[model samples]
Structures are given as C-alpha cells and as structure tokens.
Target: MRPRLPSSPPAAGVTRRGLLIGGGAGVGLILAWALWPRHYLPNLTADTGETIFGAWIKIGDDGHVTVAVPQAEHGQGVYTALPQIVADELGADWRTIAVEPAPLNPLYANALGADELFETARDTVAGRWRDAHAVRIGMMVTAGSSSVRTFEDDLRQAGAAARVLLCKVAAARWQVDWQACDTRGGFVFHGKDRLRFADLAAEAVRGSLPDALPMRVNEDDTRLSGQSLPRLDAPAKVDGSANFAGDVRLPDMVFASIRQAPGGSSRLVRVDRAAADRIPGVLQVVTNDRWVAAIGNHWWAANRALDALAPRFETQGAIVTSATIRAALQGALDTPGRRLAAVGDVDATFKDARLITAEYQVGLAAHAAVETMTATARFADGRLELWLPTLAPAMARDAAAAAAGIATDRVVVHPMLVGGAFGANLDHRCAEQAAILAVTLKRPVQLTWSRVEDLLHDRFRPPAMARMAARLGPNGQILGWRARIAAPATGQEVAARLFAQDAGFRTALALTPSGDPYAIAGAVPPYRMPAYAVDHHPADIGVPTGHWRSGAHSYTAFFTECFLDELAHLAGTEPLSYRIGMLGGDARLARCLSTAASLGGWEGGIAGSGQGIACHSFRGSHIAVLVEAHVGEGQAVSVDRIVAAVDCGRQINPDLVRQQIEGGLLFGMAAATGGSTGFTRGLPDARGFGDLGLPRLADTPDITVELISSEADPGGVSELAVPPVAPAIANALQAATGYRLRCLPLVPGTK
Candidate 1:
C-alpha cells in the first residue's frame, strides 16, 4: 500500500532564488509571510475555494474546520492543544474541528523555540520578534517546548480574523450592519437569523477584509483555553490508527539496513558487495566512506543481508573508552573556562568567607525514543520527496536536496507522526541517507535503523561535570557562589556539521565571546546570590553529543540544586525553607516551592523518614518537586511518594500539562537511577533498554501534581518538570543515608 501525501498546496516560490526567478510584487507577499504579516486577511484557501484562516486553519464548504498543526506531534497533545486555541477564539464548535500536520512552510517556523536558545533575543520583546522572523525564514524546527507558546497568539488572531470576515459577509447578505452580527458555534447570527460558517465561507473569501481585528477576550463562561479538552489525536493513537514513520509504506518501496563503522571515527575499508547481492530478496548494496547498507524488498531480508555481508572498517586510532572520556572531563575542570555569567566580586568575597565545595558528574544518556530512526524517500522528475519524523523539517529538506543534487525548492518533506523525539530527531541523517539511496537506485527507499544501530549511533546527551564553591555569610546566607562546568557544546557541534563547507567561517564564529547557550543553560542558580560566577569549559570527547530533553538544564539543575541542599545541611536549615529564603522577590519560584512543600506534607522532619525538595524555572515555567524516599537494605533507594507543583502561566490544557509533568519526572527518574550510556572500545556499550537500566512500572513512585492557575500568557511545560526530579530524588537519598551522592545513576555502592 502506498502512503498518501498531504493535500496542502506546494509553498509558493518563497526562497531567495525563487524570488529572483519569479519577479514582481508576488515575491513580496511570499516574503511577507516569512518576515511579518502586514494584513490580517486570510491569505490561504482550500481546494474547494473555501477560505483558510491564515496558514494554520482552513474552513470547508461542509462546515468542517481543519487546523494545520505546525509542530510535530510526539504524544505531547500538541495536535489537539494548538487547534483548541483557534477554536476557542473563533467561537467554533469543537466537534467540527479536525487537526492535520502542516506542510513544510516558512509560515509555520518555530520562532519561540529559537528564542529560548538565544539569550539576547529572549530577553527583549523587539529582539524576540525579530528573531522569530529570522527563524521563520531559515530554521523551521520543533523543540524547546515552544509549540503552543510560540503559535498561540498567531493562531488566535487567525481565528479572530476569519470570524470577522464571516460576520461581515453574513451582514451583507442579511442587509444588516456587521456590528449587529455575532458569531457562536461556527455560525454567524443576526437578530433573528443564523447561518453556518460553511454557508458563508465562499462569500467571506470575496468580502471586504480587515487589516487587523481584535481577538475576543477569554471569559470564564465561554473559555476553552484552560479547560481539559479531550486530546483530538488520542482516539487514533489508542486504536492504532496513528501513522508513524514505521507505519508508512509505499508501493514498490524497498527497505534498507545500515551498519556504520564500530569506532566513532573509523573509515569503512570495503564490503563484499557480491555476497550481499547474492542474498535472497536483496536488491542492492550501498556503501559510503563510513557505512555500508543493504537494500531488499523486506526489512528482515535487508537486515539479514547486511549482517551476512559483515562489512569491515579500518580503525582510526587507539580506542577511546568511558574511563578516558571521564578523565578528560575531569582534566577540563582544572583549566580556566570561559565565563558565562558573572555578578559582583566572587574572588574577593570567597577569599575570607566560610566556603562549601562539591563536585558533581552525570554520564551520557540516550533519547531512547520508542521508535527508532526511520525515513522513506522517493526521487522522481528531478525532485525528492521524503516522509520521516523530524524536529527540523526545513533542515531535513535542505539536506536531502543537497544529497540528491537538487534544488532546495525541489525537495518536499512530509513530517510523519513522531513516536517520540526527546531532542533526538533534530538531526536528519536518516532522511539524508534514504534520499541518497532513493536517488541512486531511482526507486523509493525506506530506511529503518535497527534498535542496536539506533542506540550505537545515537547523538547521546553529553556527559558533564560541574564543580561548585559557595561562600556563606555569618547569617547562613549565600554570600558568593562559583560554578565551573565541563561538557561538549551541542551548539558548536551542530554548527560545525551544518556549515562544514566553510571552516574559516565556523572558526571565526566559534571564537566569538558568545557562549554555547545549551552547555550553560541553567548553570547559574535562579536564587538571589550576592556574588556569583558561572564558567563552562567545552570539551569534545570522542562520543557524539546533542541536545537531550531540557538540554543542559537536565544536568545543571541536578548539580546546582543538590549543592544547594548540601549548603542548607551545612547551615542546619530545612531544605525547603532555605530555598524559600534565597528566593526573595521571585514570587513564582517561591510559590511553587511552598506549594510543593505543602502538598508533600513538609513539616521540617518526617520521623524516621527522609524528605527532599527542589525547584527550578526553565523556558518560562516554574516547577518544584518534593521526594520522600527510604533507603532499604543493600542501599537500595525506594521513593515512597513524589509531589510536584507547576505554574506554566495560562495552561492550554491542564490535563496535558499534568501529563507532561508526570512524563518528565519519569524520564528524569530513569536517568537518576541507572540510565548511563557507557562506552567500551570507543563505541556505545548500551544496546537496548536493559543495558541502559530504564525504570520500570514497579520503580515508579506515588505521584501527585498541583497546577497553579494564572492569567498570564502560556509558558512551556514539556521539559520544565524534568530538571527538578533528579535533584529531589538524589537529595532524598542523601537524607535517608548520611552519604552525599555527587554523580548520576545513584546505584548501590555508588557515593
């Protein structure tokens, strides 16, 4: 069975080269969508000639409302939440609303997600808007938990504009003033007459449109934004109707299996192509400088052929082991690092003040998404088309085009439903590989990486080490704080790969004073400190590293929060109370910390028990977690209960927010327990979940979550709850037993 392509129209000639080729004001309109909207009119229309409410929404003659979700749906309920924003503002019937993945277009780029990565842009409103437009033109990606936060306003405005146009059309038809018309339940109504949106959609497209329209203020009576609407994608997913990349099958499509060099940088010497071709059902053998792949009619046959071929590679040098990588990281900590954040005079204050010091380390971890990397590519008529799960569709399209020797405009990307990403899908190597094979063979090729292949080649989360030294005052306040971290810079690695052609340009850019935003994220404590300095030493160990969920915050929060707990213990103060004291003016952090404490029944001490609390703010969300655990015999730590409080300002869906928080906690707990991706002979040793020591259902704790309601704009919630869980659990274990655990994977016999 062949997979069907989406019905969305091809994007107009919007690229720089396209603009030059198609000269006129039409190019300006295309550029405007990439830059900023100057008019409020719905610019897109459906095949039925019905009006489309901006790039995200479409109205049909049959009264169905379809929302094009720009972000990839990876079980986060984004497909449902994004449309809810539009339907709520448009006064449309929720039952009539359907969601579809938006096409690869500049209009759907993730501006908010990019803003989170750049500090200067995130700090100012004008800068954020400017960067948003820049991201729209160049980087169309889905990460940083910005799906809702970035597109909320635009989606609302789109719905509001459509409603305004519909009302005007209805008013003209009824010979009444537009102001006398009202919209409700996908209908435009006069004093005594009402018409469905389908009846007026055609007229609305031809009617006079407004340059701008105000969105209806959400009232308590008719508001749906904060309400717990059922996930629109839930039924399909539950019934196994959801289409992931693995589920995508095309007619006459061949399957491919790849085997890369064992060592990180080894070179593929050669492969017995004749032997692989002799295998039953094997169609072809593709070999590159570093990898060999086998293609066949079925995945099993392709995999079998690849294994039978047993391609060999030439070793680059001495194998790099886990011990060597750890030693290098530790050595990096001794060097003077580039300062990320500095406030007040830390050196002078730390010279005479009472000081406390601790060093923390975290090992490499994998995204380990449910579905491995997979992509299907087809080349025909000098164009390349791909179906895959990708966080960055634009980058994938560009890479595929480059690999296929075609223009970027000739490449089409169909983003399939992601089984799960956790920041791993940002790289499009699988798509590129499939595209190359498809172009080479002149037939459709579907490449699916085996579990072992996926794990071994995964861009694992960078292992990091941090050393913290704090100066305490006579009153037990933090007088000065200094933190130095050593880790591979995700930004540097990604930039170098993306711009591999211009080494001089990359070097010049790397030499700039700007820090690796991801490496230093959440490195500085959020609490009020008189003198603080945070530094980062970028160390590129042999292992490949990329962004994991929450990026540096995943490990930095654990480092800083555990150290803070140690300081509190040193000061003989309660952990929760000490955090609250440092958080003076930040009411949000304080509220979350206090709320979690209250929910977890924090009353100084639980007789014969251990309780720990941790709080952090990331990507605009504030979250706090409390863990109650007991260290059983053999030093095994069992968490009895965990409580969390979150304030992600103006929740889109309370249920989804809670789900994200719970999921994030589980993810963090797995990493904290025994999720290290160790290396042997310069290769990843973890082959599957068992080797990674993933947490099971029996290991889960009794979890409770409390959402703090607010009227502010929506904030990111996807990764906000992850950073606090590890620290809280580690602190609880430390409290249960009088030994401080400074490294991750707090297993038995580890200190």
Candidate 2:
C-alpha cells in the first residue's frame, strides 16, 4: 500500500475538512474524524509503580516526576533545559525531576521549524496550513536552534495542565476548592494543609480538567527559568553510561563498514566479492548502486573486508576541482544576478562617490564532528526498528521504510543521544543503507562510517565569495553599500529535500524561489547606510553544501564586519566608535559591542594593542566579539585572548548559554585559522581533524563570555558567537601587521 501524503491542517483550532489546495496540486485533505490526532494516547511506557499523565509526564511512586524531552541531546543541554521548564511549571522539587527521550509522535513534533523552512507565501490553502500539521507532512528535525524557542509554550501548557489535574485531586481529598490549592516542592498546599503529589497522582488523570490551562507566573521566589541548573546529562556522561548511537547493542547484531564513491559522486562500477568473503571473520558483502558494505561480527573485520573488496566507481563528468568552483562563482558574480535585499537606490548613491572596494573569499568547511555517522537497524516480520543519532526521526523512519520495502507504519525510530552539530545528523544515507543491509542479511546490523569515509562524504559548508563596494562620504555619515555574494542556494536545497511534504512539492519548491534570501542573509550590514543593496549570485558549485554553524552568517558576518573595518580605516575613525554610531536603533547590539570591548580591555584597535571588535544579530540574539592576536615572524597568526558579550534574553540555564558561546568561539577560531579545505580531483584536501588545523589547548586563546541581563523572551545562543569571531580576528591581524587579508583560513602573508 502506498503511503498517504499529509493534508492541510485544521482551521480555528479544529481539524480541517474536505481537501488540501496546494500549488495547482489537487490533493484532498483527509477527514478530521478519521485522522485528526487532536487527542493523542500516551506513548511512553510506564515502569512499575509509575503513572502516566498525558504524553509528556510520568509520576513514579517515590515522587519522581519524569518529563519527556523530544529533541535529540547534542551537547546543547536540551535534556536539562527542557526538563527544567516542565519541573518549574509543575511546581515539583528540582531534585525529584528526571528526563526521558520523548516517544516519536505528532504531539512531540517540531511543527514551527518545519513550516518556516519551506511553506510557501502564496496565500493559498497550503499556505494557511503551513504553520500547522507540518510534521505530519515534512519532518521533526532539531536543528535551527529551535528546540527551546518552538516548544517552550507547549511544554509549559502540558506541565500546567498536569499540575491543575494533580491539584484538583489533592483539593478533593482535603475538602477544599481546587482554585485555593497551589503546588510547590512536589506537594499541594492550601493554607498550611499539604499532601505529596505522589500520593494523589494515581487519581489525577481522572479529574475534570479546566477549560483553559493555567500557565505559571514566575515571580521572585518560585522561578527556575533563570537559574543555572546542573546539567542532567553530565553525571551519566562522566560515568560512561550515556547511550550514544554507537553504544546501542542488540542480540546477535552484525557490524558493517561501508565504502561509498569517493569525492561525493559516482556509481559502483565493480567490486571483488570473493576477496571480501575470504577475509577473516567477514560475514557477507552487500553492494548497491551508490556504495558497498562489508558485514561481520566485528567492525574491524568488516572494515578489513571492505578494504579487501577494493570497490571501484565510475564518474560521468569532469570531477569538481577548486579551479571549477572558483570559475563558477566568478562567472556568476560577473553576471547580473538576483537582488535579494535593497534599502535604497544603491546605484544612484554610488554614482558620484569614490568607492572603497574589496573582495573576500571563504573556502569549503566540513562539519568535522568528532563522532561519525552511526546507526543500528533490525528488521523482522515486515517491521523495521532503527536506533540512530538523528534530529529527524520521522524523516528517518519514512525513508528507511521505503528502503526496506515495507509500509511506512511498519517502521519505528528510537532516537539516541548524539554529539552531532552543524547538521551532521541531518543526513539519512546511513539509515537507508542500514535498513537495506538488515533486510537482506536477515539479522540486526549496526553500520558506522569510518572517519575517512565521513570526511569524504560529509555535506560541507559551501564556499563563498563577496565583492564589497562602499561609498564613504565626509564625516563618515553619508554612505552607500553594495555586497554581491556568489554561493549555492543551500537553504533552498534543504527546504526541497528535507522540509517539503512530498516529492512533487519538493520538486516545485526546488524549481521556484530562484532568488534565495538565505544565501545572502547577512550580506546587508546592521549599520545605518543611506543606500545599500545585497545581491546573491547563485553559483552551481557541483558539490553538496548544507547549514554550517551559523548558516550563511558564518561567511556573511566575516564579509560585513571585515569590510566595516576597512571603511573605518578609509574614513580615519576609531573602528569601535564608527560601528556603534551607525547602530542608531539597536541598543541591545550596541550594548553587546560596548560590553565586549570593555571586557577585552578596549584600546581602539591600536597598532600594538592588536585589538579588533565585531558585532552581529542572529536568531534573535545579539553578540559582539573582540580578539587580540599577532602575526608572528613566519606569518603565523597567534591568538592571545577572545572576549564576547551576548544578550540572548531570559536564559533557561545561564551556564548552558555561556557554554554555547564559549564552544562557538572555539569552533569559529578553528574555522578562521584551519577549518578550510580545497577540492582536488573531486576530493577535499583535508582528510581528518589533523588536516583541518583544530586548535589544541596550547594553540587556543584565553576566552571569556559575558551574558547580559534582559527580561525579554529567550533567544537562540548556539550559533550566535560563530559569525563574529572570524572578522574580529582578521581585523585584529590587520591592525597589528598594517596589511589586509581578504580570504579565510587567514594566512597572514596573503592579501
């Protein structure tokens, strides 16, 4: 039976009836009564003495309140921050709170992110349904730093509803009005009369729920949202009990190692199956069009078998070389491309002014996560089960079922903890391959990509080039700015491949939206420019590119900030004051800049001080970075210190915010100094971490981050710090050496 496509979401908080009217696609919406899923049955399994409360809460006999967190734990502290929300709203003792991975269900889907990724702005019936029921159509991914922002309200409501139910049960037993009873520290209280929630939880689910759930109002003494709770996953990690995807074990599981076409393109031409079979401990060799895998009881044996097989692949066209990529981008920029952002008449503003022009280039950067791709699959009775480190479990299940030749409902995905970041876990090649291996071998299979294979096939951050031309006038007040960037439409491809509801819709999305705003997101400066235009010259690099640490801002920030420094120099003004002056309305961003400068010991980017400053706004978060570095005798850039100020607003865990900022700083530093590679004969020159020039303790600078206080709603912190570091370091180096470097992987001797 063919799988059914998702229909339009319900209207007015009720299920939609009739049909979905998409972009000329006459697809009918399913009847609400048949598949509304408005009321979801609890999917979490309860342990002995534990009572289930809806889909998110479970209360054990000993008073432990466990909250179900749906996002994959990827060192972002979702397990801790999310559970903190539930515990705070439920008025439970922090010590009594625990967390479990939420079961895969529509109730736990990331609908907002899915809708925002690709939903059309056509104002049609499909457009109306975009924000709702997206997970039923697209996927439940955990990227975009949206876990806290998208799910906060839902988690709060779930906790509040549960608390109300528990309070009512307690109030009934105490012979008091339920409205007069309040909960705190895992107990219900009414004028000095109290009872443990554990004692009443068994009967709470049966109580009459109010028409409207009451959300918590956090005041002085009862708020946990701002406190720095100890990370819930820390203890398990230290004790080596955390179950990463690689740690999953099953009865009679076989290990598989695969060899795909190198250089990210090819079809398997031939392989020596007999040689692979002769290898000691080798179970069998499975070959597909795109890759071949060797299965065995041990990974090492399987890897050796793969090596012995010596698979060969054939390429149809000229392999993408660095020269080709450069030529493609240069040609695109030379052409009159689509303009995505315009503040005023840039051509008219620049007509009579002497423009300060510069060109900057950034090379390809890989995700380079320490953990490679790993997934476990077991198939039996036409049903497939997968244990994988993935942000999109629903997407994985749907794709895996297809690969295994089974119905969509016959698949279940048990998401495991991952160290995946920068979109490493978003790919489904491993899951698809594992499912195929399991169905063919008639046994359980666990596949792990070797580091070399991981590097060779990783979806890299697209290489980009920007030509910046700015007109600076008297007093540095009158200015015109134009940035023409050439890069791949990464976000468009992501939307088409991962976010569209069906293949037909995906195809339509990929073809349309020819002008991609996401490709040139940060090209426009935050400063006050009289006239400015940001244009995107979409280049077909003939290589795969996906979301990096900061999306397009990773490169665009470097482009904008570094150019701002050049403009400041041309105008003979202090770089810090010049940027802050342009920040007329963004007080929050200006504060971040000022605070970072103070923290780093502001010295005006002087000749010897080696101080440089950069600030940016991303994902509703504002951040400023300052770097102190020097170009040494051999042109080697040595970083001494890095200081950052962030205003993410309403911290769930201040410690986590600080950690993310710190981590982003280090990741950015690596990218600035060594996180780039060039393609040669369809393969990247950097093959491993050693090749990428990762910073060690000795090479790392002393880093400090300050979290600004704000009562505003929470903003994303994970990728906020990444975009500004490169430009800060580059500007600092220019201040020290009196020379400018316009390319990434800043080699001081280059121009």
Index of the highest-lDDT prediction: 2
TM-score for candidate 1, please give it. 0.91
lDDT, each prediction: 0.80, 0.83
Reference-based TM-score, model 2: 0.93
lDDT of 1 by residue, 563-641 (tens): 9999988888888888989997989989998899888998663334578889999888899999988777666767788
Candidate 2 regions off by >4 Å?
1-42, 115-129, 263-265, 499-501, 504-512
List runs of model 1 lying over 4 Å from the truth: 1-45, 48-50, 118-133, 136-138, 218-220, 274-278, 498-512, 605-608
RMSD of 1: 5.5
Per-residue lDDT for 446-514 in model 2, tens only? 999998888888888889999999888788764789999999988787665454336544534433445
- Lowest summed lDDT over 10 consecutive residues: which window, candidate 2? 15-24
Cα lDDT of model 2 overall? 0.83
TM-score of each: 0.91, 0.93
Ten contiguous residues minimizing lDDT sum, candidate 1: 1-10
Per-prediction tally of clashes: 0, 3
